[model samples]
Target: MKLLNDDLRNQLKEVFQDMKDDVTIAVFTKSGTCNTCTETISFMEEIETLSDKIHLKKLDIENDAELAKAYDVQMVPSIVLLNKDEAYVGIKFNGIPAGHEINSFIPGILEVSGSGEQLPEGFLKQLETVKKPVNIKVFVTLSCPHCPGAVQKAHKLALENEFINAEMIEAQTFDEISNKFNVSSVPKIVINDQYEFVGNQPLEVFVEEIQKTQA
Candidate 1:
């Protein structure tokens, strides 16, 4: 098993610590690659050791093909972070979430999952204009926790405005939207005909963009 160095371990520690509630670290692995797969499994075990709150579940791609398909995990050696009820925190690791990258993934999970619970006050000013129905398309993946928050925010606005049509385009399912919009990131939001907003923006900003679509 590969052990994380002191620096990386500390960083991953900070990430799990920020979790307001329990989190599940889903490790999706394939059996073929001797170097990458072996190292990834060992790395996840080390992460599992770091905390009891951060539970780890390993699944075989070959055996659990449908499981991987459901989450749209097209590649091996991916780490997905989930909240208490298995809500996504949008933490998807491609190669491995080790070293500097480890720090990035965990923090994102907390922030994305946390962002939707409460938005900032000033950010509300951003959502002042919603005059017409705009096809606010949000492209997401199951592994992304932040995507739900973004989707929730969109739904919130959808409830408020008659002219607003908010829809989520699962990137794995809606490959066209992903390719058309160049969706290389998680929780990417696009408004009307041209404007693009990535990440979970505050509700105010979302409202502001809705108004912009009228222009």
Candidate 2:
């Protein structure tokens, strides 16, 4: 079954036309362990067909244990974006990029494909002050409409800052992880396991939350 229709495919092709570099979508999924693993692969395959610059590398955690560990993918249906240089930029999608999260996924590929930074000068300056390492885990569900904004913001920060890493944890697929974080709602932003907030926050508010991690 095809996930994208002809019209959507054309739109995506147009969106991807600006890609200056190739992007590799590294996916880790295990058969029988993840209910959405097969479908996620199919969805990525369809997206790959829309752009020449997009490549998909499918890896099963069970079979590719070492690679999975290297990427720190502890759950199934995990995806990480890498640039043409094969460098993992720390932009990760821990769940199936479905629903509103698809908005984040598409732009992630484009941003990773481009050369220059997507962030503004001020944002970069703020990130420079971040001396401590920050690990951000955004808990989301495919049905959540507001989750994409938080995920996109987290990903762009990860892309720009070497000391920060952001991951989108599918609340449903990684129930144990979600439970650990007490993610009862969608778009639960956890920073360094110390500071956390809910909902889609303004960029400044998000930055303030990140700053709180250093306190």
Q: Which candidate number would show the highest TM-score if scored against the true structure?
A: 2
Per-residue lDDT of model 1, residues 2-58, tens digit only: 567888678767766756666676777877663466777787778777766667778
> In angstroms, how far off is 130's CA in candidate 2?
2.2
TM-score of 2: 0.93
lDDT per residue for candidate 2 within 4-78, as digits (tens), equals 988889899998998899999999998785788899999999988888888999998889998787777888889
List RMSD in Å for every model shown. 8.4, 1.6
Score every model by TM-score: 0.52, 0.93
For residue 59, give model 2's deviation from the true position in Å. Answer: 0.8
Backbone clashes in candidate 2 total 0
Error of 1 at 128 (Å): 12
Q: Roughly what TM-score does model 1 have, to 2 decimal places?
A: 0.52
Clash pairs (backbone) in predicted model 2:
none
